[model samples]
Structures are given as C-alpha cells and as structure tokens.
Target: MNTSAPDEGRIDTEVRGHLLLITINRPAKRNGFTPAMYRQLAAAYTRLDDEPALRVGVLMAAGDHFTAGLDLPTFAPLMQRGEQAAPAGGVEPTEPGMAGYRRRQKPVVVAVKGITYTLGIELMLAADVVVAADNCRFSQLEVKRGIMATGGATLRMAERAGAGNALLHLLTGDEFGAAEALRLNFVQKVVPPAQVEQETLQIAEQIAQQAPLAVVATRLNVLKAIEHGPLAAMEEFEATQQRLSRSEDAAEGVRSFVERRPAKFTGR
Candidate 1:
C-alpha cells in the first residue's frame, strides 16, 4: 500500500505482507531531515504501531546515504526559540524524558548506508536491530555544530555502545566506519551496499512471521528490563504469561505444534 505523508513527500511508506517499509526519500540532500520530513517519518512510525496488520517495520533510505542528519539551518529558528518541534500527524519520535520515543510495542529494523550523521546514528540506536552497509559512515556531529545530540543519543548511546566508546565519538564528533560501528555494537550486522535493504527486509519478515502478541511481549519485556530493573521486569512475567496462555493464538500455537505444522497466528 502507498502511505505517503500529506506534504512534501519526504517520507515514503509501502506495505509488504505484514512489514511496513518506511524509506527516507530526500536523497538529493542526502536525506537531510527538515521539519516536514521528521513529521512524515513520525507519522509513518505511528501508522506502523496503529495498524494491526503491520507486524514489523523496516526503516531504510532511498539513496546512497541514509541521512545527513537534521537540516540545522531550517531548525535554527525552533532551537533559538527553545521550542521542541512537534510532528504534524503522529506521535513525537522523542519525548521529554524518554529515550527513543519511536520505540513502539512492535519491532522495527533499520538499514543504513553512506553518510549517517547525528540523528541518523540515534535513529539506528533506537531500532531493535540495525543493518549497515560496508560503505556506511557514521558521526554524531551535533557537538561540532555547537549543539548537543538531543534525539535520544545522549541516553541510548552509552547503553548500546558502551559509555567509553559512545563518548569517544560524541566528544570528538569524528566519523567512524561500519567496522567500528559493529565493534562498538552500534550496528547489529554489516553487509555490502547492494544487500543492505534486502538483508533488513529479510530480518523484518522473520520477525513479522512470529506471533504478533508474543513478539510484542518479548520486545516489551526486554525494554522493561533495560529501562527499569530486573525486578520490575519480573513483576510482569507471571501476569503476561497467564494472559497469553488464555489467548487464542496461544492455543493455536500448541495445536499447530501437535499437528507438526507451521502455526498460523492471528495476533489474538
């Protein structure tokens, strides 16, 4: 399905089976995100969560580069006014205190290539899994631009890439290659440029094939464990297990296992 945001057409959306394919379309500017672009991207993500048919989302770019980060010139006025930009039609991708506000109950995978700067890196970090092209270059250059990385980078970077490694790049605003990103755990996988999208889609498809409720529960459990403590996560274990056990999909799962056939989950 074609799900283009209302204005500018900066973000493109396509539905393939249960996967929502969201592509950054402003390649001419190396996918630099203007305010309109951010709104469109946020709208797509919100649609993914709101639509029950969409079990997973794959975020990739249309051009060689994933994104050049924010268009600082266009955003300078908002920054000067100390105002947070709001999305035009969807949930805000970043909240006041939450890190990675785009993280929905459903899973999201990201594929990146070429120059991924500032917000680009943060977007990757926000995703459940990342696939980076060999030619991908990443940098959190906000500090160099006399601004700080506010798009969940400060909160999520250390958690994903270790405090020392995150600071090394954040402090210096230096560019790093895909290999470095992999080593730092910034990216989950690295493939050739030609295969980045394919690989990402494959992973998203695999996740989409699973029972949607179980998949969402698993992701939520992990996030709860990370954001809260193990004790807090454990608190939900019994309740969640009991709830799922009574679900129709859970019964189907057991019956399918007994029949030695692939389970057809209905997201019950």
Candidate 2:
C-alpha cells in the first residue's frame, strides 16, 4: 500500500494483485473530501488507468463511515467562484465537468457504510457497481445545501432507477437506508458493515481475473450504449470482436476451454 501526498486528508492506494484498492482516509471528519483530497484521488485514478498491471479498482473508505461529503468550508468558495480545479496533470475521478481529463476506460466498484451523503452518493452512483453496508445512511442533500448535485447523480440516478425514485431523494434531500438503496437499484449488494469491503474486493477480484482487454471493452460498450444509442454501440460490436479474437488472450481462452481448465489470462 502506498500513501500518496498526505495532507489535511489523503487518498491511499494499494495494488493487490490486479486490483487497485483506493481508500479515503480521514476518519476524524468521517472521511470528508477536501480539495487536496480530490486531487489526490484523481491522481490515484490516473495511476490505475495508466498501469497495465492494474485491471480493476475498488473504492472504499477507512473508519466507520464512508464519507460525510465535501468539506464545504474549503469547497464552497471554489463553487462560488465557479472554478473546479483538478490536479495539474491528473484525471478527474468524480465528474467530467470538474476537469479536463476523460473518463476512465476501466471499471470501478465502490463500497460504502454509515453516512454517505451528497457527493458521496453521487460518487457511488457514478461507479459501475456498489456494495453498501446495512448500516449505511445515504442522502443526496445538495438541494438542502442551496446547491444541486453537479456530479453524475443528476444524469445517472434517473437512468439507473426511475426518475420518480431518484427525485424523491434528490428533491427532498431525505435520508434513505440500505434497503431503500437496494430497492432503488442504487446498490448491487447490501451486507453487514464488517463484510462490505471484503464483498466489494471479491467482486473487483472477479473482474480483475478476466481478460483485461475484454473487461475494458465490455465496460466501454455498456457506457457507449448509455451515452450514445444502443444501435450506435452495437454497430461497433463486430469491430470489437474482430479485434479481440486476434489477441493472444483469445487464443489462451480457446486453449483453456479445450483443456477444461480455468484460464490463466496474462491480459494479453
């Protein structure tokens, strides 16, 4: 595990086999994010995307709670100035409107517990998969703060769940529990607080075990379908398959199938 740029709050990154475990560390403040922390996290995301050895990312937090949301005292002025500054040469992990970098091609799984408010929920909503602890208390309370969810929540939440379901929470700024999160299709799994991280890690490991090219291609296709039309995404399937079929990993997949054994993919 490498702790990068320790400041008021920091983002800790660990490379576990092919999985990049990103932890938000600041238990005293319930892991709230400062501007420096956001830059650190963006750097970590950039690291994950640039490293060929890393295939998947698991985002979690240290301590009893996931996050209480942003440190308004630090971020409010920036918001007022209409300036969202990213790292000097790093990707923006949270929202595209916040930075100049492109979205990550790789997949990310998020694990949350206790208080997950405002931007915390937005972050989870932006991720590909979510594992929430039964003790989780989620709220998209930006409206209550005299602001709106500028993150992906406004765009993604309605698409994932129904608009009414998303609006119920987004509009009223009401708190919801894990059960409601599951019902709203906001979380993939709800486990005991003790098991949230382990469960999420297991899921990320499963993704990492697959052929790296195929995994990224699959995620990209899904995202393309969401951003563009399904027909547009489907139009690229033939080209994608033609490319993947020519890779060495594809040959290994055939051999492993013929041998009736688990494939040991080198991400070729």
Candidate 3:
C-alpha cells in the first residue's frame, strides 16, 4: 500500500480502498517541493490512467503547512530544466508536463494548513477540491520576490476568484487569511487545523464511494465548460452524453433509480 516516491521521500502515496492518499513528506522543509518531488508527483499521476482501481485522490502534507512553495535549490534548477527543453514556438512550457497536458481525470482533493505560500496556492488551483484549516495563510509573493507568479495562476486564478481579486493578490503579492480565501471561494471549506485531514478524507471517501466513470466524466466536462464557452461545452457534453448512455453503468443507474436503490457500478 505504501507507494511512496523514491526520489527524495518527499511524497508518500498509499491506496486505501479506492482512494489514493498522497502526503508531502518533507515536514522539515515545511513540505517545500523539490524537483525530485514534482517529477515524482507527475510520475505517480501518469499511472492513474492505467490504474482503474484508483477512484479518488487526496494531496496533503505532514506537519503544519501544506507547503512553503518550491524549495530554493529545487526552484533554481527549474529554470535550468526549463531552459533545457527544446523551444516550441519560441516558448517553453510553463510547468513541467503542462503544455498539451490534460489536467488529471479523477477528482484530486487537497487539505491546506498553515503558511501556504506562492506556488503553494497554485497547487490547490490544480486540485478539484480544497479544504483548508482556519489559520491557513495564502499568498502569491513571487512577484514581490522579483519574479512573476507564472505557475498558471496568473491566468487561471482570475476565472476562480474574479479578475479584481486575482490582480489584488498576484499583483500585490500580499498575504490573505483563510477566512478571506473562503470568502473569495478559493477553498471549498475551512475547518479547524486539527480537523483538516479528517474533513478532507471524509469528503474523499464520499467521492470514492461514487461511480468512478461518472465522477471522471463529470470532472472532465466541468473543467472543459469552465475553460471553453458554453456552446463548445454543450457540444462536448452532447458527445459525452451519447457515449456514456451506451455504458452499462448508465443502464444500472436507471435501474437503480426506478428501483429506489443504490446503484452498484462496475465503472464501465
């Protein structure tokens, strides 16, 4: 069950039932991600496509903070790594494995605690749902540190938190409290620090109990709807509806609905 990444022991991946629990293990560094950790995460996620048993996933960290953003030694190498990539259209991919990459299929959940910084919040944006502790602090201070917050938040955060809020946070690089994060809808919910992990897993278990294919399909369609216009989304949704209707799960769902019973789906 322990599929912890071998790179720096920064990531601990374990499958409990249908849920994959991913814990950032570098508590000493406040869970700051090194290059090895990032690559390991990407590598682990890549296997999800082939692993049919993984129905849900959660990302959390040991100790207080979820992450203090990228490690200095690790981040310095990102530039070097980015520079090494063959230039495509005179631009390198912003984040490793991001350009032309499909955001993951299964729902990805996160539990953010204290002192989330800069790219720390960006990782939450990548997740489908985020649960935060009441005292969690968030910021995009890369701009204040003489760098832009180009970790995809400059473009995506606006859609989630509105243009004004995005500008205020990213442009100013100011710290925001968890209460403000909840108000802006950055996090799905905020619980006491001690309850973050429990609450996140409670939600994760609910997610894992559902029909896997339906969850994945809904996640994919919903993200597309957010990125594309409603018309384009409608087209994709129609296509998806047609495909899913023929699945055995669709039939089981209808039968269960008519029978007033819970449906047991095989993820077909």
Residue 213, candidate 1: C-alpha displacement in angstroms: 0.7
> How are the candidates ranked when ordered by TM-score, highest leading?
2, 1, 3
| Runs off by more than 4 Å, candidate 3 | 1-9, 80-97
Residue pairs with backbone overlap in model 2: none
Query: Best by TM-score, which number?
Result: 2
Q: On lDDT, who's better, 1 or 3?
A: 1
lDDT string, candidate 1, 53-141, tens digits: 99998999876899999988888998899766654334565432443345467888999999999889888887889999999989998
Q: Residue 58 deviation, candidate 1, in Å?
A: 0.9
- Ten-residue region with minimum lDDT total, candidate 2: 1-10
lDDT of 2 by residue, 1-268 (tens): 5433344788888888998899999888888899888888888888988999998989999888999999889999999998774664566776544445667878899999999998798888878899999999999989888988887788878988878888888899999999999998889999999899999999999998889999999998998898898998999999999999999999999999999998888878
| Deviation (Å) of 233 in candidate 3 | 0.4
Evaluate all candidate structures by whole-model CA lDDT and list the values in order.
0.85, 0.87, 0.77
Q: Candidate 2, overall lDDT?
A: 0.87
The top-ranked prediction according to lDDT is 2
- Cα lDDT for residue 106, model 1? 81
- Clashes (N, CA, C under 3 Å) per candidate: 0, 0, 0
